[model samples]
Target: MENRAVLAAVLMAALLILYQVFFIPATAPPPPARAPEGVSKPVPPQEKTAPPPPAVLPAAKVLPRLPERTVSVDTPLYHAIVGSEGGRLLGWTLHYRGEKVLAERGQMGLSGLILERSGVGGQPVEFSITGGPVVLDGKAGEGTLVMTGEDAYGVRVRETATFRADQYAVDLSVRLENGRRVRQTLTVALPWIAPVKPGTDGAQWPSELVWQVDGTVHREPFDKATVAEETPGDWAGLDSLYYLTALIPKRPPTSPGLSLAVGKVGEDRVEVGLRGAVTLAAGEVWEARAQLYAGPKEYRQLRAHGLEGAINFGGFPLPRKYGGLPMEWLGVPVLLVMNFFYRFIGNYGVAIILLTVVTKVLFYPLTVKSMTSMKKMQTIQPQANALRAKHKSDPQRAQRETLELYRREGVNPLGGCLPMVIQVPIFYALYIALSVSVELQNAGFICFGRAPGWFPFVGGTDLWICDLAAPDPLYVLPILMGVTMFVQQKMQPTMGDPNQAKMMLIMPFVFTFMFLKLPSGLVLYWTVSNALQILQQRLMNRKPARVAGRGAKDVARV
Candidate 1:
């Protein structure tokens, strides 16, 4: 039986290796070829054509230009014409009330503002803003605005001239018939920080500016001398054009830096802010508009907005298909539960623990049955050993006797294995969930520190350490997991020869080492599960030594 287990494990491992090395790559489609320039085919000649003389006509009288009318309103509720050019959000104009934005042929930078594009073709993107008497500065005003399209690369502008002021932030509030009102406040509080050139003195400053997004009020001094390489993309693999740095001050200031980060909350949607600590004025609702990107990371957003790649955190080499699907599928449920737990427990670590407990409880029955079957196998080890020894030379006969013994004892040899096999999919699903879970990105877990740096391949500023998007280090966890696994195996009844038991010990180490570099959350799951299993085994059975002695005595009598 031990030999059989070793063979099964070896077969499974071979299959996995083959699947990863050959099958998966084979299934991926080849990349498209690039088109060559200046390649044109000759056109066919027309069959026939008629030549005609040209005639000149007198110029018609010029028509007078029509006067453009404008509308004004007292209420804040109004539609805005929004648009983007070359993937950059330009601006928006209040359709009925505000002044029109000049159709400029230059790039417009709405720095520090989150913007997302909508509408098709040259069609205007429209959104309603309610809740204002139109406050521009210290006064109230109103005007008509029209935002037009431009025909140039990287040139976008939304014309609105209600009362432009350099000092005051623009506030637009909108009310819906459903009684939900939204207020969008636009503030140009800070200058657009330029991207620190690589190998320059300023580059180090951006890298040294440590920002925390765990709803904590901590600050680190801005180091103009620190430099760090910029990651290429956002969380969704979109291009990152800017490198964001926290404006931490040495001394406590009256005001602190403000920014938002986006992460996936669930299956269908990404949560924009998980731990943003922004305050809203009384009667002033806060709203954020950002381009929700779902693609590969590049420097596009940073180049366009100068806001840096606030979304990208590195880890894991999850094949996009396998990685993205599981994350997207289980993101919502996991986040929802996590959020609920955090709200009540006030600790993200506790939330994860609770989440794990809940999950295990949900799968308790299967695990219980698996344990029971393992116990039965242990109980019948003596008979199994006897059968194996009786037909040692005849391997097929040995297997047949073993099967008959299992049937007679009402034991399923594969029963214990089946539940574990069933759990693979579930474990994989959770693995995907935790890997892409934005909630867990900067989240903390005791002294282990932030999720990123807590374990290998999880956290840290280094690309290798931060590569949450790749496979793990495969050294620590896998070995520990294998050790625990071997111990669990040792606690189980043995039916095979010395070779089989030796293989069992080796198998645990192999699996444990395989998991070392995986996400800490996945490791946490396995570790916790293993501990529980050990406890469960101890509680379920009496002295294994005594059982083994009884089995040996029975074998001797036979």
Candidate 2:
């Protein structure tokens, strides 16, 4: 019981630390006066400026007359809109696990390509399409949208966006023909911006710019007055909780002109994107070919495209340079197994339950060893108390006798503690996976959408618990989790100081309060895990071995 309490305390303290690091609400800075939509030039991180100014469009010296009509492209994986005047992407909606992440943000244009010149004045080329609203039926012959236009300033531009009915990626190519007599350098910006959704406080909003620089991923929150960074990378974009919009250059720019910018577009609105530069000489036709991905941030899908770096599984509060260490190493395997189970079970909640069962089965041997060691220690509690009483006059003698007693009984004092410690990484891995996996967002185990008769008041999933990604509205899971934890603690063999045992009893309540507002899926994982531990403990401790002829004898073999 002492070892059990120690293990519980250590686990709880670690969990609280992790929770504070990952989930504590980020304090939003005082709202700045709304800034205009544009790219803010990159600034040195150490410098401070008074009333940091808004960003400017790298591609446009003056804002062009954007078209009123928006062209829509519908595909199986995503839906996108493009404006006619600038041929800019106006909106992108991601569909995954039967949930729409960006559809409700009305007219939220996500990712689009652009062109800019440093000395050239006047709005960048305003593209006019000859034909539009391409509808692709991902078949033997896929559909495509081609928009072509030319500027009077000796530059002609053509943008062709091809879509397939079944894939999330949009094959895009921007061809620029420089008809000038001298060489010209143009800044190409692919802005991937989405309107911040309503009803979400600044703390809950995960709006951010994420990118990979030299094989390392960097994530920056867009809540500040201005944020701009230049890096050397071929891929960059922005993301929310479930959706991602990224641009990958088929050919990297000549110079490391990759920069990220985020600025306010209107009241309660933010726009973000990446900018790069390309130089064109007289009569030189330059074509920038790239792939655009706008869809859910599913691990498998992102991994297939080498964008797995996008999925962040939170780990120890170490600096990101440490790579989140053991958690990242373990999280991927756990997530893969969960995804595999989900394929067969067809529900994330059920998958999590199966995951817990499998983990228990895998660790059965260690658990049995730990429990057996603790039970042996409990069996010798009377002798241990007598020794302490006998040695009341000699503190050193009592400690020596205790060590001798353990050795004579052939019980390893560290056995009970080591096994529990070994199990920490596995549980931590599952915690990180459940919290970050896109597959769990809006997933339901016993959803009312599938079975309305089961849930009346909260018609989402499992009676009162509807969305697994969100908290349990009625707090039933958290309470049950606390109860199971208490039961598991009670099942451990009692051989600890009274004060420490009392502390163990209060831990469950502390955990219950702490988990009140966490994701239901996470709480469900804990509750199921605790119940399994209880069942395992009961089975292991059912028939205690009896002492006979100076040796322990088992009545039945486990």
Per-prediction count of colliding residue pairs?
65, 7
User: Residue 212 of candidate 1: its Cα lDDT?
Assistant: 34
For residues 1-558, write the lDDT of model 2, one tens digit per residue. 999999999999999979976998634233334222222122233224255333232232233566456778776676677776556665555556553545333345543455665555334456666555667655533566777766655667888777777667777777776666555566766665555453452222337767776677777666552434445564676676766777665543443434545555565565655555655545556555667777777888787667778777765645456655636678898889999999898888999899888998999999988988888877776666777878899989998988887787787889888999988878877888888877777787665443454567645445555578888777889999999999999888885699889999999999999999999999998999899888888887776744322432221210
Per-residue CA lDDT of candidate 1, range 511-553, in tens?
7757766665566656667767787778767534324455655
Worst 10 residues of 2 by lDDT: 34-43
Clashes of 1: 65
lDDT of each: 0.40, 0.68
What are the clashing pairs of model 2? Answer: 38-55, 39-55, 39-56, 40-55, 59-116, 90-109, 448-460
Q: Model 2 compared with the native: what TM-score?
A: 0.78
Cα lDDT for residue 339, model 2?
91
User: Candidate 1, 534: how far from true, in Å?
Assistant: 1.6
